[model samples]
Structure formats: C-alpha cells, structure tokens
Target chain A: MSELTLKANIDRPDDFYADLLAAHEGLPKAQSDALNARLILVLANQVGDREVLKDALAAAKQAMHRDPARS
Target chain B: MTKIFETPLYPYERSADQDAAEPVRHPVVVIGAGPIGLAAAIDLARHDVPVVILDENDKVSWGSRAICFAKRPLEILDRLGCGQEMVDKGVQWNLGKVFFGDRKVYDFNLLPEEGHHRPAFINLQQYYFEEYLVNRARALEAEGKPIDLRGGSKVTAVEAKDDGVLLTVETPDGPYRIAADWVIACDGAGSPVRSMMGLDFVGRVFEDNFLIADVVMEAGFPTERWFWFDPPFNKGQSALLHKQPDNVWRIDLQLGWDIDKEKEKKPENVIPRLKAMLGEDAKFELEWVSIYTFQCRRMEKFRHGRVIFAGDAAHQVSPFGARGANSGLQDTDNLIWKLKLVMEGKAPETLLDSYDAERVHAADENILNSSRSTDFITPKSDQSRIFRDAVLDLAEHFEFARPIVNSGRLSVPATYDGSPLNGPDVAGMPDRTRPGAPAVDAPIGNGWLLSRLGDRFQLMTIDADAPDRIDVEGIEVERLELSTNDDPSGALAERYLGDAQAGIYLMRPDQHVAARWTKFNEAELRSAVNTATGALSNRVETPD
Candidate 1:
C-alpha cells in the first residue's frame, strides 16, 4: 500500500490546464515527451525522501497500468 | 526639518515658437521627456544638432520607478555631463544576497574589475535621474545649441512623409503643428506614436502581478540587494528588499494572479504585508504602493520611414532585472549618433538601419532574460516549481548549482555578437571587448581611456606611436604609450593590447570596437569605418 495522496490541490484547474498546454505549445512531440520526462525526474528529487518518491511512482504506475476499476 | 523626499514639479512654459505663423521645422523632434528622450536631446546637442523635446507631463516620475541604473547608462550619462552628479547623489552597491527561506544560498559580486570610472550600479529614483538630464539640457540650451523642452504639450496627430514627419501638437494655450526632418518616439511603453501608426506591439505576458511598495523607515537595512524565494512571513511566493537613498526601502512582494489589485494597493491592505516582512511593531509609513503586471513585448520593426521608435516605445521587458531604463538609454545612445551623422549628410540613411538591428537584438536579449527570470520565480506547473525548489535547495550545498539559481540576473551590457558592423577578428584579439563589443574603460595616463575617446572615431595604439598623416577622414588617432610596466596595474595593456602583443585598434564614435590589427594602415581603417557606418550595405541582418 503506497502512502501517496491525490487530492484537489489546484485552486483554479482551468488556468492550470491552459498553462500546461501553453508550455507544450511550440514543442514537437518528441521534445514534449522529453520535457515531461525531465519534469518527472525533477519532481521526484523534490519529493526528496526516497520513500515518498517510491510511493508516488507506484501510484503513477498504477494509473498507467490496466484500469483498476475494470480489474 | 522633516526630510522631504518628494520631487519638485517643473512648471510648463509657453515655447517661443507657439506663436509662430509658419510651421517651425527642426532637425529632430523627440517625444516624451523621460530618461530616453532627454538623453536623445543631450546627445544631439553635444553633436551640435538642434533638437526639441515634448512631454505631456510637467513633473518627473511620481515614485522610484527604475531605481537601478546600470554601468552602461552611467557611462552614457557621464558623456552627457550628469554622470558624476548622479553618482554623488545615489547609493552605490555591487553585492546581492539570495536566500531560500531562512538560509542564505549564495552571495555574488558584480563589476569585479577595477580602474573603471563608474560602479556596477547605483540606486536612485527616476525623478533624480530626469532632473539631472533636464538641467543638462537647459545648460546646453543656454550655450547656443538649443534643446527646446516643452512640457504640457501633447502630440495629437502624426502623419508620415517621404522625407520628414508632420506632427500635430496640442498645448495648454491652443493647438499647433510642427514638422521635423525626423521624429523619434520615446513616449514610453504605452507609446501613442506607435499606436497612431497602427502598429502591433505584441509579446508574452506574464500572469503574475507584483506589489511594489516604498516605505520610509529608519531600520538599519544593508545597502545590498536581498531576495528571498519563500521567506517565513510569505508562504510560497518570492519577495525582494533593496535600500535606496533617503532611508527609503523598496519591498517587492509577489501577489498571486488571483488577488484583487485595487484592494491590495490600499494602505489598509498594504500595511499588513509590510508588517509581515518587517515586523509587527515596525514604525513605517507607506510612501507609495502600486500593483504592476509585466509584458515582454516589442514592435515588429523600430524604424517606420520618417518616424522612429526607441526606449519603451519600441520594446519593453519585465522590471525584475532593471533592463527597462538601461536598455532604453542604450537605444538613445545608439540612435543619436547615427541620426546626427545622417542629418549632417556625413553617413548615408542606411546607418539608421543598424540602430534597428543592434537595439532589437539587445531588446530580445533583455526580454529572454526577464521572461526566464519570471518563469523561475513564478513557476506555472508543479513540475516547474519542483525544479525551481530543487535548484534553491541544492544551491546551498553544491557550488555548481549556485549558478543555476535565478533571482533576476542583474542587467549587463548586451554584446552585438554577430552584427554586420563587426569587422574580421584579427590575430591576438581580446575576448569580451572584441569587434562589435562596446569598449571597456581602463586607466590611460592621468585620466580614463573612455574620457579621452569621446564622440569621435578613436585609434588607440598601445606601446606604439600612431602613424602620421593617416588619410581616413573623421578618424582621430590616440597613441597610448603603456611601455610594458608603465601601466602598473596592467589594465590598459590587457584591454587594448592582447596577450599575443596586438597593439593597433580602431574604435567607432559610439565606442564600439570596429577593427583591430597590429600594423597600421589607412585603407583598412577606412574600410572598417565604412562597415561601421553601414556604408557597404543597406539592410541589417534580420533573424531567420
């Protein structure tokens, strides 16, 4: 059981969504993917405590894996 | 006597030409009486060009807008005869301290090199800077070269021409019209002249709004700049503190994009923010408070046939790095010299094209730095914030990470890296002061090297005598005899004569390096000047 928490953290989701899209605007598909990869590693480092990073990683992998609701 | 820091307003007077029956024509007309416009007038007067400046307002800046004056602008002011006065009245500082929460990340130094006339930067309000320039312009006016500075005169209409510009101006008394051989728009970021032409001024707009408040307090704060990412009082946003003259402290707080700007500017709302940074019991009165949002924008082209744009009128940047005024003064510096030559029929009309080329490059550089600093301080995404925080945290431990921390990289002079005016880099050339770079100051005998090399083409030959009867017109040879150890500090030798023993160099009137060679010849120097003045080509290299 990963101790990762997903909550409503954003104050305004609409503006955040627009900004996220703006960041990826001029970038090519491959470059956008590279930016996402770098962004993940940076976030992992700030999650500083390795246990928290592992927990976040497990939660992210679970999201990407076969649908949990369907399973 | 209570110390009065408020700026005195100058009364607008009726110009002698207001009653003229015919439209009075001038060599040049400068709009807006800010630092850029006054500099244009003063620089033109120094070159014996008659100029007239118009400003709608009679007073200087209300607050301490553009508090930091960089070294390059200081040098330009020094040439205009107000540099020393500004330095005498302003507080000089070079060190800046950056912090993450309660811990100091790193302290950095600017202008490490010595023997220069001006310091790295000075903290003075925009009012004082404008006063000095206005006084200098008046002094020039008394000496036969008249700079007619008209306040309370607003330009209502501007029509283009094949050779000149027709300006319809409205004064306090009545409406009048004037014509100029050329018109320069220095009317600030909300430039009316640019808008009259229906030009699109567009760029990236940062969503973050900053609350800048100036407080008059007697607390013993150091003169150096202090910037904190997330201090104890402020939870997540960044803050900055800097000391100005007259016990005034400038505090900049990052108010998130969602705050009410009108309510935040009220004294009731601003006092608490100041208390949070200073103390609960801090005895301070708010002198000024304003909320500002920055945009990094510029016109598509600075030159519009007979009309031209400069300073904030042409381009703008975020105020975080103090690039606004510094780069604007650079625009006047680059424009006036070329305009003088062109008006005098000495240089071709194409010389003005280089002003557009060089300053647009400079504007882009400032915008890039300012935009990046804004992103670093106010990261949009959590991932972006994570990287910023990681840099802030790692900066405390790793020396390599310290350079990556960005808290408004202080303004430095722009280098025209690949300018067409640049000549070939000859043997034994120096690095920073290379071709297309502004000349650096060093000690030469009793005075500084830059003082001797004013508004004329200078040929400084180190350790070697200048050749006699050099046939290139307008080129003045200045022979520097720095015989090995004569320059005890080796500052002159290092800047002019490279390590490989290169001695001869050619400099443009604006003090940019044109060409350099060990051997002196007339033909090569002439060709270099032709290139420097845009004589060889008509178009500047546009970015692809």
Candidate 2:
C-alpha cells in the first residue's frame, strides 16, 4: 500500500548528492540544519500523500538505528 | 470626547413582570444583552416569539474588543436587519501582508473572486457593533414587536425544569422570579447560568498573553491588515495592526507569558511599544489598553433540556482568528430559526439536538483552527520553533512555504459535513453548495442569492421545474425558481451546479443546503424535508 520509493530513484545519484552538499556550502551548522529542515518540509509538501510520508519517516528512522557494517 | 460606551443605551427599568403576583412565564428569556444575546432576542421576536434580554450593564462594552467582523457574520447581520449600517460604518478590507523581521513576505487577499455582496471582512469596534444591534432591537420594539431589553438586570440563579427554567433576576429595584418555557444563555465566557447548572468548559488553556491597544491617530497607512513576526520592535514575538473607523487603529502585540499584565497595560508602558511599532515620531492617543490570555475550550454539550447555551457561554476560542464574536453570531443564526420551529411545534423537539450537534461541530472547528494559529504564533518547544522559523524563513523565497505560514486562519463559516439533519447529496454537483454547507451567495437579477434564501425553508430550482409550495406536516417549503439567464454573470450556475444540467436544492431556514438532486423527485423531496426538520420516522434513507 505504500507508494514511497525507498530505493534509489534519482537519475544521477552522485550528482544529486553533490548538489545537496553544495547547497549547504559556506553556511554554518545551524544554517545548514535549518536548510535541511526546510528542504524536508518542502519536499513533504510536494509528496503530499500522508501514507507515503509516514512510510518514508518509518524507513528513515529504521535506517538511523541499522548497523552500517551489515550493508 | 464622550464615547458611546459611556452612555446608557438600555438603562434598567422596572418591568411589568417583576411586579406581577406569580412568576410570569415567557416564551423565551435570553440571559445577556451582549451582541449574541441581543441578536437571539431580535431573531426570536422577529418570528413573533415573545423574548426578553437581561443584562447587568446598560451600555456597550467599554473597550474595542473583537474588532474583525467576517463576511459570514456580516451576512447574518443582514438577516437581522443591521448589515447595511455595519458595512457603512466599518472599514472594509481584504488584503493582508505578512512580515518576518523587517522584511515583507507575500501579501494575500481573503476574497479573491467577485459577485458576493459583502466584503471579506470589516474592522469595527465591538461597542459600535453592539450599538447598531441595540438600535435594531429598539426599532423592532417600536414597531410593537414582542421584545424587551432590560439593562442592569443580572440573572443570579437558574433552575432548569422539565418544562422550563426558573430564573432569579436581580434588577435595580429588587430581585424577581421569572420563568420561561425555554432559556438561551448568552452570558459570555464566565456564564453565570452555566455555573448555576454546574457546567464547565473542557479544552486547552494557552499560556501566552496579548496586549491589545486601540489608539486614535492620523496616518497614511492603507486600510489593510499588517502582521509582523519577530520584527525589530517586538523581538521574537508577533504583532498585528488593523485600521478601524474614526481614524482609530487597533494594535496587538504578543507579550510572552510571565509578564506583569497590569504594568503592561499602563499607558506609560504601552505608549512606547506603540511608538516602536508605529514610528517614534508618530502622534497618537491611547483610547484603550488591555491584556488578554485566551483559552480554546467549550462546553461538553451546548443543550441541556429547557436550558440551551449559545455564544461564548457555550464555547470559547483563542482570539487569533477573530472567531469569538463571529462564531457567536453564527451560533445564534443557526439556533434561533430552529428554536422558532420547535416552539411552534412545526418541527420535532429533536431538532434542538441538531443545533447542539451542528454548533458543537462548528465550535470544535473554530477551536482547532484558532488553537493551531496560537501554537504557530507561540511555539511551545525549541524543535517547534525551529520548524516554525524554517517555514517563515523559506516563505520569503518560495511561494509553497507561504501557505504553511499560519498567522491566523481567519474565521469562515463552518460546514456541517456530517450533521444528522443533513439530507441527501447527489453526485456531479458542485461541492461548495453540497448538503450541510451554507448557501453561497451569487448575483441573481439585481440582488444576491443569500439575501433571498434565509428566514425560512425554501425549495430553490435552477432550470428545474418544481411546485410553488410544498407543505410537509406543518412546515411550509416555498419555491424560489431561477434560471441561468437571470444572472448574466453566470455565478449562480457555476456555484450551484458544476457539470449537472439542472438542480433542485432544499434549503433550511438557516440557508444551509439540506439536499440537492439533479431532477425533481416528489418522494425524495418530501423525505428530505422531513429529515431536515428532524422528523425521524419519515427518513427513508441515511446519507453516506
């Protein structure tokens, strides 16, 4: 029932990652953290489905506690 | 200058009922002369029901409270015969600008479309609003209407009986006992009648204070709402500015919790805050200053036997959205007509319960919206503030984030989506005029749609044939036939019919759509009329 694409879905993964980091360049930690929060909110609105958002939140939380070495 | 609040508009006078041998029983006794109570009395009296309004004070309120009047309440006032005067004297505005720090964010319009009779909102002092209502009441009384406005008469005690309510009203002379077949308590937030009945509101109490200052000044500021968030003047707080009639402006500054309210309200202390918001060189005189901390709460139920609660007596909400008086006006507008029907025995007594259900639904909506606005304005935790500030920060750059910004989701009429009294809703019709929604105003001929709909049950037909009148049991449903050609602007069909070719709409006395069908069906129309009047036995089917 979940429509969230948890797997890699971007066309250019490295370029997208580089752009995300570049957007936060020349900014302090607080400013970068605020920008991240704002980006999440803006994207959540774009992904307006509540069910998808909920699944994405759970998946994100699960990854935070997962053992990185298992990957 | 002598203000209107200083004059006794309805000073106390000994009534004939007070001197009677037995407690005189009236049809209805309203327990306050505030705007809500007065409007209720006027509405009941307009229906030929004898009504009495008892209040402790003789004049309008002392301060400029509840300054913003929304369009729905303005339309309700039109039904009560004072809308024109309010619009004439009040400052009409629809544009609002939101600010963050010293920078201006996007400005929005409350009413973007046209063809509606009333403006989106008007700014008028509560005193002037009450004075206009009082004048209407006096006019009705002069025309030999069955209405009484007794000032300085305080209702000290209330006993709700199976048949009626016994009230002890203390007047200028002495206390007297009076009884009414039904009682409407509109005595405001700290309702004495509610206390006498051992009732209490249940909800959240916000922990913040707002200082409201009404000042008289000559300024070049346009008639638009200006709201500031964390400006240089008021650091880390929100502020609102609105222009009212008579060169007077209302300013609200968010003073964080744990401040001395008395010291904050002092003119010497308040003038500096005003000078900072309005430049230091601006000249102004303080008219009124008060500190208010609000709660979002309401009674568990609005009705209990012969005693019913309306206005702030029934529910209370934070003032951020101007929902206090606006919703109260709506409460009475939804109630009085149903009370009239029940009193006349044309509708079942169960109809009163729908008032409880529908208005409690509206109250919950108002509470939810105003509470959200309060939370946004005064974020509780550090995380919430971060998110709030992020939205404001992003709003300056992106249009998507602007909608996330919640200054106050200003008051709009509540749509009773799942009200028990709602009838049927056919598919393919516009949702704006769906069942249980208030009738949208559209230009018809030279007049407006709402002006012709309220005051009684009407069967409105748009390019659909219907009988002139239909009487279900004892209630009469008159017909209002219209064609799309009548409105050259094409607003009527666009609002009432989307893709449907023709429509037949059943409207209640409150001008809410009870049911709509694509074509005329006699049995369905009859059943819908029965259901709308709370005649449970005639209900053929339940609405999904």
Candidate 3:
C-alpha cells in the first residue's frame, strides 16, 4: 500500500502557521499546522478552486494570528 | 376629530390612507411569515434584495407542528446563522426503528456521516424555528436590510403586471395596495393568493382520514419511529407513534373510509381512539387533535405571470412521509437563488420558469412517494389489503422484502430531469451523480473531503489544461493539480492532491456534481462550461 502524501503551497509562512493554529485551536502547537494543512486541502478539494482555497487558507491564517489562544 | 379606534399596539397611529399609500417598490414581495416564508425572506434579504414579507397572522403560530428537520435543511439553516442555534435547541437523532403489527421488524441508521462540524438531523418545533427566522428578519430590518414584515395584513387581490405585480391588501387600518417586481404566495395550503390567481390544483383525495393527536406520555416511548400495521386498536387501520421535540409524542390513527371527517374532530370521538391506542389503563392528556384528510395534489403551474406559489400553496402531500412542511421549505430553498439571479439581471425572465419546472418535479416526486406510503399502510381496497398483507408476511422471512416493509426509497432525493439544466446521461441514470444531488467525497489537500460548493451556480473545471478557455464573464476558476496514480511517486499526487488522480469535476453551488472528465481539453472544457452555465454564446475571455 502506498502512503498518500498531500502537500499544498502557502504564500506566506506566518499566515500558514497562523491558520494552522486557528484550525487546531484546542490542540497543541505541534499538531495545529499538520491539521490546518489537512483541513485546507479538504476544503480546496471540495471547492476545487485554487483561488477560493487560497482565500480560505489566508482567512484561516489571519484568524490564528489574531488569537494565538486559538492554537 | 373623529374618534379613532386606536390601541397601544398602534403607537404610530398610522391612518388608513397612510397605510394604503404606495411606497417605494422592491424587487420581491413574499407573503406569509411562517418558517418557510421567513427563511425565504432571510436569504433574499441577505443577498441585498429589497424584499417585503406579509403575513395575515400578527404572531407566529404555537405548537410543535414540524418535529423532524433533515440534514440538508439544517445545513441551509446553518448558513443563515440559525442552524447552530437550532441544533442547540433540538434533539438530534440518526437511528430509527420500524415495527410490523406489534412485532419488531427491522431498524436502520443514517450511514457514513460527513462533516465533524455538522449533525445529521434535529427534532425541533416549527414554532421555535419561526422564532429564529423572525428574529433574523427583524435584525436585518433594523439595519435597513429589512424584510418588511406586515403582520395581520391580508392580500385581497394580486394582479401580475408587465414590470411586476399589483397587490390589493387589507390591513388593520384599511385597504392598501402594493406593487413589486415579483410576488410569492407562501400563505400555505389554503392560500388565498393561490386562489385569486385562478391556478387549478389537481390530485386525488385518499379514502382514509387520520386522527392526529399530540400527547405527553408518562414515560418516553422508543426514541425511534414505530408503525403498527392493522393494529388491533384501530381494527382495520394502521397507527403511527413518532417522537416530537419537548416530552411529547405524535400519534396518527386511521379512520376508515366511512367516517365523517368533521365528526371525527369532536373530542368524544378523538378521545376514544386515543384511549384505544394508549391502552385501557394508560393515562395521557391531549394537547391538540384534528381530523386531516390526505390529498396528493400540486398546482398545475407554480407561477402565474410574475406571481409564484411556494410551500403548501404550490403542493400538498400526505403527512405519512413528513413531506408537507419539509418540502415547502425545500421549495423556498430552490427558488431563492433563481430569484436572486433574476433580481440582479444575471439571468433572464426565462430563468424564473425553471422554478416551476424543478419544484413541480420535486412536489410530484413527494406526492408519489407519500401516496405509496399511505397505500401500503392504509390498504383502501380488498385487493390492495391482500397485497400489503402478503408483502408484510414475506417481510418476516425474506431480507428482499425488508426494504419494501420500510420504504427507504421514498426518503431519497428526487432529480430535476425535466430541467433544461440537466444534460445527457440524465435519463435512466442512477441518482448518485445527478444534478441537485448532495456533494460527494473528493481528495483535497491531505485527506478525504466531501462538501457542497455550488450553492449559487454551477462551477466547471477549477484547474484545467488551458486557463484561457472559460467564457462566462465574472465567473471565477481555480487551477490546481492532484496526485494521479499514473505518477504514484510524483509530487503532484503524493504531495498536493491527497494521493488522488488528476481529474476535473464540475460542481453546482448546492454542492451537487454537474459533470466530470478524466483529462482536460481547452475546447472541450470550454463547451462544457457553456453547457453547464446555459450561457449559449455568452462567452468571455479568461485570465491566462
């Protein structure tokens, strides 16, 4: 069985990490980015739009940065 | 000054002339303030359309008429910011049980649930549902995005105009008139608006009348649904026990063909029927009781010029499948988007015709299913009774007969095939990938993802071969790659596409699939986009 790896591009490092933190607001910082990455990919796959995915990613990132407590 | 019939509620002291005077016209006028009407008004108002919603009732009705809300309607409510609140207030259930004549037959559960953020179904009162919607309507009104709720105002006449409609309404003060670009009748089954338009509602009246009673039991019965075929209490009829929100239960008793519907409503007659079902010693107080005749009918046309009919006004189905109010709300859901498009001039008046096509199809499907359910349980004729009994008997020994006993197919969503939006492969095709079907699971960034994206319009090829081919102006496209099996070790699939193959799938805003292609070709994809949008020659250049 092959281990499917999913990767996505993040325009900004802090934004990506921030979105990661916000998505996993209740989780430890170590798990937040990985979880955020997974969530972003899922939504992008659903919308299937590179633009909306980017917008969703940026929004998630901004939310995390606004409140580190979200992490 | 002449003595005025003013009350504390009339703080503005509004006069007959002032109330009757024509005000600035809006793009849409929605009649009725019930849950369906308010829900329709909320969505249209959110899209910035000037809307007026009128209801003859001064206040929302009480009693938990509609108890169960499906996942789809719940999701729609959530989008309007009221779903979460509804979830908080209602009891959620996904598992239900069925009984055949006092014996447990089988049970089923809503399988493979999606979305960690959303629940499958909620049991809440229609009264509370209206409360949430009305609050939203009032809040929007405060912000000047008002829903224009004219409570206690009755529409006496509605005439469609070239530009819109002219409505003659009677208010507390006096009669007044209103003109708008569109008029929607959501006033319910006995809609005056539907009558004034002279639209013929056609269908057959069932032979059986149901004595519906809502009672508070000493102890909660099974949380799941229970149906008894030919129960001893009713002798030759079937009985249904369903859970309502609060600590109550709704029971339906079949009154055979010979009983008078009006006389059956009398408490004396209703009490005996209720007592028989509750048992000789069981004690319960009835909240409300009514004798309802079943009719599976729909207006021949949902629209008369600029005036449209929605909910019960447009169609009526038996309560066997809980299709009445639920279908009405779904009607509004389908209409709101098209109305928004026409209001914005994004689509022509022809687009409004699709409302009748799609919704009438839905209504027809509901009627067919509900009628079948009624037939199976009621068994009007001797031949039908024999057939139903034979099936129920076979259901005991054969798994094949189990589905018939439970009727799962009746609950599934119906397609809008007659719809011009539907393309080839629609005929005789299974509903799995059809238009208006729920969204499916797809590979996103790193994991399996399922979502309903095309809530407003159809989306074709987000990331395709050539970025320059899409022609609809103002249409947005996204370009991206997913991992394909051909390149198992390639970064595209392993790193970005969640280990999935590269393919293009078109989505409708309601999150149903329109079409899919394994590979992208610019000319082919361009044509697909045009077909999906119904744009014909209305093409615009795309950014490379």
TM-score per candidate: 0.86, 0.96, 0.75
Residue range B364-469, candidate 2, lDDT tens digits: 9999999999889889987788888899988988988998899999999999999988888988899899999999999999899988988998999999999999
Each model's RMSD to truth, in Å?
Answer: 9.5, 2.9, 20.6
Per residue, candidate 1 scores C-alpha lDDT tens digits across A1-71 of 24555887777999989988998999997567655655564565556677778777787887785767976
Candidate 1 C-alpha lDDT tens digits along B1-544: 4222244344578776778888888889999999899998899988788888989887777778889998888988888888998999898887888988988988877745797888888999887888888889888888888678888889999998998998988987988889999999999999999989899899998888889998999997788899999888777889999988888889999888899999999999999889989999899878888899889999888999989899999999998789999999988888888887788776789889888899899999999999889888888887677677777776777665677788887788888878877775665667867887888888766777777665776676766556643534443445433454555778877776676564666777777787777766666666776777777443333223
TM-score of predicted chain B, candidate 2: 0.98
The lowest-lDDT stretch of 10 consecutive residues in candidate 1 chain B is: B1-10
Model 2, backbone clash pairs (residues 3+ apart or across chains), number:
0
What C-alpha lDDT values do all the predictions have?
0.81, 0.91, 0.65
- Candidate 2 runs further than 4 Å off: A10-29, A61-71, B538-544
Decreasing DockQ order of the candidates: 2, 1, 3
Q: How does residue B544 of candidate 2 score in lDDT?
A: 35
C-alpha DockQ of every model:
0.04, 0.61, 0.01
User: Best candidate per DockQ, number?
Assistant: 2
List, residue by residue over B1-544, the lDDT tens digit for candidate 3.
2111121111222333345446446678898877788888888887788788877666555456666676667666755657777888787666666666666666667653442345555677676677778778777778788567777677898887788888877776777787888888899888888888777888989877777887877754667666777777877777877776666777888777788877888888888888887777777877767677868899998978788899888899887766777777777777777777667665566767777887888898988888888778877676566556656655665555556663323344455664665533323333455544555434444543333343454333323443533434444434333334323334323322332233455554444455555456555445544444455455523435
Q: In model 1, where do residues sit more than 4 Å from their true spots?
A: A1-71, B1-9, B468-486, B537-544
Compose the digit string of candidate 2's lDDT tens values, residues A27-69.
Answer: 9988887888898999988898999999999989887856779
Pick the lDDT winner.
Answer: 2
Chain B, candidate 1: TM? 0.95
Model 2's TM-score against the true structure: 0.96
Best by TM-score: 2
For model 2, which pairs clash? Answer: none
